[model samples]
Target: MAGRNMNVYFQEETYSKIKNLVAKREISRFINEAVEEKLKQRQQQQKEELRKKLIVGYQSRIKNKKLQKILLTYGEMSWEDLSAKLEEQEKNDDNCKK
Candidate 1:
């Protein structure tokens, strides 16, 4: 509380809502608690989004490996190309692990 000073402008209806919520209690404390809870919710949402992206990427990788196997069996690609691709994939995996 002592470390922050900020201004926020709200519509009349929104201001009224906030006042109504704290009409029978300490307004400052109520607002502080509400803001804290909202920040926590935002942080949690960001974490969940990152987790979902990682899961999708992992699934897509498995699909790519399957396709590569099919192509290799049909002799549609060269060993040199396959080896290079494997090296690139390894690099990406190492980056993700870090």
Candidate 2:
């Protein structure tokens, strides 16, 4: 791969520590690899966040669809029919309590 020359500033103490930790020739390579790894981690975290958002959106749509189905079922009923259904459900609940 082609490389470009760029100047980077580091704190004196940090730079001294890094110099102590790595050979002079491999410092740039080490920094490059560390940056690449960090970038990959950031990209993976972004993908996971998007996946979670998609899952939540999908679940919301499913919930809305279920709500729509329930509304559609009851929307066709007359007030008297709804009242009768409510009364029947109440009776069933009363029975279940016994």
Candidate 3:
């Protein structure tokens, strides 16, 4: 495959190990594969983190929609009925907060 040639450096100890273990002509290939593997790992981690954030955001929206429904129910109640309903809703809010 066609590739760019650029200067690269490694610590003396690491370079020694790489030269000892890898064929001299293949050191560039070894470093390239290592970089590719690390890139894949980071990309996968970012995708997973974004997925988790999306799920949390969706759950929050659903909770807000339910609260809106509850508010509508209260809006139709008589003042005398509202106190009991408000107290019930407060208890539910406390439970959900935990």
Candidate 4:
């Protein structure tokens, strides 16, 4: 793929290892591939962490008595109607807080 040139610094030992392990001219490609892989791994790790947090949040909400009461009161409504009711309630709440 086409790319731009930039400078990157590596510690002495790490630099020496890469230089010795890769073909002299392929150092840039080796580093680019390594960086891309590391970025992908980190992004995947972050997504998994967020998913776990969301599950925890949802579990906590399920255990809330207030939320349970609200759900029970609105549960009989159609999903679309219930959403509208909840949004209206939220707006009323924000107005009250002000």
Candidate 5:
């Protein structure tokens, strides 16, 4: 944990809930869980942005004709080689797939 600081903000009804959590000796645990979840969501968003940037960067660098040529060329390879190629392709393809 580095460069972390706290500032308090209150919503209309959540303070009592937080206070109850504190009285139960679970406030820190709850806060940590909330932080962990927020971090996870932020990380996921950053990952998605990076992926989008890479896709745009790659597409800007290569033409569709070139990509199609590469795929078609792989399609002509030996079955074992093609299977390996397809597996690799499938892994990368899965990243963009929801």
Candidate 6:
């Protein structure tokens, strides 16, 4: 990639630390590599977060489809039958918890 020249200012203490850690001839390369590494790490982190969000959204859509199917199956049933079914489901859930 082509590079551009830009001036960057650092605090005196920070500059001193870098000077201490790196030879003057290699300071620019050291800073460039550090910045590139940090950028890559941030990009990877964002990708992972996005992947997790996509998985959650996909699972939510699947759950909605399953719920829709259940509702459709019960569409022709009477209100009393639906209420009884709900009660039975709640009882089963309670039993599982116990």
Q: Which structure among the candidates has the greatest lDDT?
A: 2
Query: Which residue pairs does candidate 3 place in steric collision?
Result: none
Summed over model 1, clashes come to: 0
For model 5 the TM-score comes to: 0.50
TM-score of 3: 0.64
Predicted candidate 5, C-alpha RMSD: 17.2
The CA-based lDDT of model 5 is what? 0.82
Per-residue lDDT tens digits for candidate 5, residues 1-98, read: 44454776878578787886575676656777798999999999999999999999888767677878887897789999988877998998998795
Candidate 4 residue pairs in clash (backbone atoms < 3 Å): none
Alpha carbon deviation, residue 22, candidate 5 (Å) = 6.7
lDDT of 1 by residue, 17-94 (tens): 888776756766776888999999999999999999999999998879978798777586588878888899999999
Q: Which stretches of candidate 5 lie over 4 Å from their true place?
A: 1-7, 20-23, 64-98
lDDT of 3 by residue, 1-98 (tens): 99998988889999999999999999999999998999999999999999999999999988799788988887888898998877899999999999
> Candidate order by lDDT, highest to lowest?
2, 6, 3, 4, 1, 5
Best prediction by TM-score: 4
Please list the C-alpha lDDT of all candidates, in the order they appear: 0.84, 0.96, 0.93, 0.92, 0.82, 0.94
Indicate the residue-level lDDT of 47 in model 3: 100
Quote the positional error of residue 4 for candidate 6 in Å.
1.3
| Prediction 4 global C-alpha lDDT | 0.92
Ranking by TM-score: 4, 2, 6, 3, 1, 5
Tally clashing residue pairs in candidate 2: 0
Worst 10 residues of 5 by lDDT: 1-10
Q: How many residue pairs clash (N, CA or C atoms closer than 3 angstroms) in each of the candidate models, in the order given?
A: 0, 0, 0, 0, 0, 0
- Residue 76 in model 4: lDDT: 75
Superposed on all Cα atoms, the candidates' RMSDs to the truth, in angstroms, are 13.9, 6.0, 9.0, 10.8, 17.2, 8.1
Give the TM-score comparing model 2 with the true structure, all chains together: 0.66
User: After superposition, which runs of candidate 2 have C-alpha atoms over 4 Å from their true positions?
Assistant: 67-98
